[model samples]
Target chain A: MPTTLIGLDGVPYGLITSYAEKGYLPNIASLIARGEIVQMESTIPDVSSTAWSSVITGANPGEHGVFGFFDIDRQTGRLCFPQFSDIHVSPFWEGKKAAAINIPQTYPARIENGLMVSGFVSPTVEKAVSPAGWLEKVRELDYRIDVDSSLAQESMEKFLDDLYAVLDSRMRLFRETRDAEKWDIYYFVFTGTDRINHFLFDAWDDESSEYHKPFVDYYRKVDECVGEILSTLKPEEKIYIHSDHGFCPLEKEFYVNRWLVEKGYLEFATDSPALITDMSPSSKAFSLDPGRIYINAKDRFPNGSVGTGDREKIKAEITEKIMRLESDSVCPVARVADGCEVFWGPVSSRGPDLVFLGRRGIDIKSLVAVDGLFGKRIFRGMHTQDDAFLIAGQKENLPSPFHVSRIASLVV
Target chain B: MEYLDYLENKSIYVIRESYARFKNMALLWSMGKDSTTLLHLCMKAFMGKIPFPVIHIDTGFKFPEMYEFRDRTARRLGLDLIVAENRLAKYRGMGPNKAGASKLECCNALKTESLQQIVAKLKIQSLLVGIRRDEHGIRAKERYFSARDESFKWNYTDQTAEPWDYYRSLERDGTHFRVHPILHMTEADIWRYISREKLEVIDLYFAKGGKRYRSIGCAPCCEPVESSASTIYEIILEIESSKTAERAGRAQDKEDAYTMQKLRSLGYM
Candidate 1:
């Protein structure tokens, strides 16, 4: 008997009920009939990097140190991602010999011994080592490599055609690898579904939209791939499928950061030419170091200088002003935290003097700085902080949160 | 079954379901941990065979290593690779430095526009991506099999009901469904699976010169964070208890509030 694990990017259990009931996903329905389904509690913020890090490390965000999608460096006042090199904990893969394919957002592109495939949004060769062995195989199969975004329209079509071919090719390669090599574990990932959702979520309706037929057709195509994999599976092999979290519809847009700026918690330079061109009375600055404000003291003040005495007074005044606006519903300004604790580094290098968190139901829009935070049209959908779903092939022998740390323990 | 077991099981089931459902689907490869891990899962689901094409959208501004890694991994995995780029934008000299367009515009031209064109050209209905709700406040509202309009706009107010273990795949008219296979697992579960499976991963994750790529992106936009942890184990430990965001190194994100949301709304992946 063989053990196989298939992970999805964002397949929520709740969303699958319709497909199963309607027989859209018969294989999955059959799996459910034979197995137990469970809900997995996700970490706070539930961001991909942090959640995935936790999954690999079997630790919490507090333990993994991957808090959000972005973080401010306490020392240099720079924003950064939590890289594997920056992590101090051990992942189960470190002890086992396995092949990993298509992991997103990971850098350096170096793995222990097994084969490796990077994901989208990753850095290029200058930023990380090239897995030439993998590249050669793909190229031999006539895979396309896009070096620039110059011929976007033409390139996109080419990309799509190539994507379909690659999926088939990769599946064939997997079968070959399984037959040619004797390995304990092997893994690969697919991201077409998530991409479709991000761009075509609105196209899956009954309306006479140009993307309607194409979206439906794509789903059917993906279904065929699922069937193909099932057909090739050994009878005794255990198959497990899952996702990081579910999707939701978006609606209203809010500029929480802009609200903070209006409240005077965050101060900007008025004299600098760049600042003059960029900053509007309604514009807001976004900082990962919540509650910390970076004040250009030298250029912001009327006398071409901001004295320490004046800076302290301004900081104090801003804190008070923000506190007063915390409960205002129209404005998304939540309570402002103390900068001294929220921001790190010397007073000069740290972020804003004040940090703000939006109240529930408020999501700051990215256009706040350029378009002025207020008065933007509302979006139809939004995200939620819900627990993700997990289903196991063998109910009794599945992994648990408490035993998460033991995943590597068992594999190694 | 334990939470981890349940997560793994669900992910595998979703992957298989996706393979079974879509006839002409492709996996979007960003060369990131999540998507890379997703590729691994596809192999596992098929017992070493990835049954779909791998698509990479080249914005022409990605870090050089990303291209190298993409080429290397695709070849090694024997994957059918498709590289998409917005030639119009590139030829027009569209880049991060453009003044009027802002970062969101830049992404639209390079990423969103390119993706839209690719999907239309390939007539791709199902696209597999590695998006996690926890990654962004707006992402939390997404559905596993989400519906999209022809123009690719996401309608949050009117969403279909999603019960347990069932999804809505067949769309009336010409609409399409977005499938997410790993919507249940968390960052911890992914790492645990990677470790347990001893999956091979990228090396930029490790620190260099007391600085590590907290997140890897374009050379001009992506920056490193100061860290002393040199090994994966050490990196994992640091991740378990950090208060930073993963995309801190990406400059576009800091351009303003809701920058990501705006880009996403405009169809930027």
Candidate 2:
């Protein structure tokens, strides 16, 4: 019997019953019927890089080194992605020959002795690995492909037309490749469902109050795609459908950074303007990036230095300040264990001496005189701290929903 | 075929969804692992072909190697690359060195403005990004299909509810949408996928002189972390035990409390 695994990005298990009942996903429902589907608990941070890493490596965030999408360099204070070369562990696929295609958040198409296709949102051809030899031959036989969006709306349609033509050709290429390649493993990814959900969510509702249509159309299309793939698959293959996490609506927006500044945990230079001209300034400063913050300890103190003793004091002070701020309802803050929940801590060398979590409905705002800092209004449609789903083959032998860490064990 | 098969399937699903739904779309490629992986997914969705153009907003301060890798990859992948720049800021000789502006403002000038101009010029109706909800507090609240108005404002309060896979697109007023294909994924899954697929990612991720890129961004703004794990296996071990955030090396995020949130609200990628 042949084995096939299908991974669905961001397919929340919570809504599967409803979607399946509505006939929006018969293929998925049938697969679930044949197999057991369970909610898989995600990592503490629940971020993609971290979660995906855990899923593939069967490890936690502490083991993957991918805490978030952007991390500060300790020495240079620059932000960057943890590259493949930076990885310190071996993934299960290291020795296995497999055809890997477009896994979001893992770039450069790193499959050996098998085909590799990149994902969406990557930079143009000028920024990706070139297809060589057999891949190039495949490209030639495929339709003309050009992935470029013009700067003008008038030319936008042309871009889409070109895109569609390429897509059609590539679909053909996929069929050809799959049929010709007699391999033990094959992998593929798609982002259309996510795109539609983000853009047209508001179009479906008669209430005209919330974003709606994009998700509906996207899933409908996904269902169709699934149907097509199912028709092409053999009975012996095992299909696994899953998502990274779940989704929710945004109720409110809170500017946590501004709240932090107001609460006094963070301080800035009074002598000079809050903004600095040089990349590396000599003045005191405080800034926020999502849930984390950074303080210029060297420039803030009179002596311009933060000693080890001072580090403890600063940590205590910052923690107390953040806790107080959380109590005051200025922002949503939570204390999480090191590898258990989302908490504030060092991200890299230049990370904020302290970190905080902005509650689900809250959006952090800074009082700094930046272009978008002030006068920013509230937003709707938010994310939630929920465990996503992982459906492996038939539901009979799946792991518990809460124990997502065990997903690798199932496959291995 | 075990874990790698699962990772590949999920990514392909996201790529196809993005292609079929949004009429006008583009991608944000920072030349980093996550975004680059997203790019690779696009090709896979189309079966070894990418249908959409890829955008790279050059802030002129990226590491020299990043640019080299960018060019080489573009040539190799046969990508339609669109380079967006903040011409006005560049003309004014603006950079991270401007003292009056906070790191947040610097990002606005270099990244936000460049992205806005590119969107306007391209008339992009939707943008496919590689952001994950687990990355940050504010990001944790984001939807798979996030909407943005004409001025690129993100109204988190009035967002539509996505009950399960039934997402609501077509905003009443927004000109574009921000799509997150990997919102539900965790940090560990990404690493696992990379390892399982043997994906070719940027070399900077590995430790250099006992340091590695915990997260990547601009040259002057991003930083690395201390680690002895130079190989992928060792790095995984370090991550499993560390307590640091991913952006610890980034300087701009430390300028204010809500720096990233503010920048994101203004359409900063």
Candidate 3:
């Protein structure tokens, strides 16, 4: 029997424990009861692309060189959105047949064996799946490779409706593919769980929240899907149910760029959309998504100011400052490690010098169009540092303090 | 020295390359500024006459002026025009008027399905489309010359690489390709080119009662955004200051999270 890995993209462990405690998710509760649970840890930034790659390749961000959805080339000072093709190492199931579906950051879909339907951020539809024949089979089911959730900015109702429709279609696709293919390993990921949390997470805590029932109802559907998929697995086959990272209700959006400007570490040439290269010559440091700080060392950037001897001082100072940060709606920063400290291998020089992690509820951002620290937020949920857990029935040689990357090897 | 000239030159380069590469080629004319600009580039590419046919995947629900302008321009330019529609699909119940499902369903039925049928019917090996990267998030990741399988499915992630003005491997064994002459151009570039070429445009783009269609699809799904731009120059100025994305007014894209991706995969224009 083949191992089946069911990834609930961003459904937190805490959410699952609570839902199971209340008997809302009996299937998940039963899995926790049987499978050995390992508190799975995500990457430093805990982005979908990097975390998923880690799980696929059985390596750290240091080894795989995918820090986030995007990467900045230190040589040219140009930013590049890295894709699945950028993964240096082959996946754990290399040369083995596996049916992979809807996994985020796996676009430009590739597999040595088996079929792959690339998930989010795919550029085109034809290339998202391999062996051109599989394209129509997936298309006929009205299967969408991704959801254009940008519409949610204006209409939440349409967003929710589409999410539900996608969920139902996903279940249909899963069963269709499962029955059709004979594979050694099967993998499927659902991104709707993350999208729902981003929009209606406030409802999770507040029963009176307007979309409360819809939110809970969505989980119930997820629960039903889990049960259906799990029941199909044979007694000998193993199952792994997990999420990439946890989530908490978001309140204030903290603009780290604004903080840098206020502290006189960064100076902008102009406003509007602030690019990293827009920093003035006198600027000492700049940053990118999810709290990545790069010290503008002498000769490093075109407008580099900070020297070699002064980098550690600058990194230490900013680390302390960001760590102590707290405001009315924002919680205190939990961990503020240097980028080099967080990621290792060849990506150190190309990566950030400082990586900061803030507590959940305060959404973190690098760009600031306005001259302020706090800003308006459209989203209600934010990624938390305390990531979710992974439960698997196979109990051979598990790392006592295992990371999520090890999950791929456990099945192999 | 003008930016518009550089844009025209680049677009002309793409158009010439597409013409030289593929045999069974056609161009898409949406009767909008982007596709109209593409036509202008096509004329320039072949020196005053386009050798290939221009295709318009008509849904039969466009603005009246669109039809009028399309006919007027097609006659004026002496274009080898071919209008493709899935009338059978429409007769079998499509369009927003036949609403039980989403407007997206109608799009899939009437627009995407129709185009796929027409292309296969013509045995079109390639199409010269006017898709810009800035139009939608899904479009942002498209290749200059994108291939679709026999099923007309676009693989967004698994696309071919373009290196130094060279798009490798002109044809595939079991797939057709779409050639985007203006994939790199922005919304602002289209207006600038329209001004430079003195091209005729759909009147819906200009402000009427303090609003204009930033993006034109079908009459029912398209909405006009608040604008004061009355001329091409003013529209360029609007593009410079506009905060909203060009496709924000297109309703079908917002029907679900991935409607655009799904539509594009199914060969929707």
TM-score ranking, best first: 3, 2, 1
Assess every candidate by TM-score. Answer: 0.47, 0.51, 0.59
Model 3 lDDT, residue A291, Cα: 74
Candidate 3: lDDT of A234? 77
Quantify all predictions' global Cα lDDT against the true fold.
0.54, 0.56, 0.76
Residues forming the 10-long window of minimal summed lDDT in candidate 3 chain B: B260-269
**Which candidate would rank higher by lDDT, 2 or 3?**
3
Largest lDDT belongs to which candidate? 3
Kindly report the docking quality category of candidate 2. Answer: incorrect
What does candidate 1's lDDT look like per residue over A115-174, in tens digits? 555443344432322346666565455432211222223444453454466566656655
Worst 10 residues of 3 chain A by lDDT: A71-80
DockQ scores of the candidates:
0.01, 0.01, 0.01
Per-model TM-score (chain A alone): 0.67, 0.73, 0.92
Off by over 4 Å in 2: A1-3, A124-131, A134-173, A198-211, A263-290, A293-306, A310-320, A323-331, A334-358, A363-380, A402-405, B1-269
Q: How much TM-score does chain B earn in each model?
A: 0.83, 0.85, 0.87
Query: Best TM-score goes to which candidate?
Result: 3
Q: Please, what are the lDDT tens digits per residue for candidate 2 over residues A165-192?
A: 5545545655765655654555555443
Chain A only: give the TM-score of model 3.
0.92
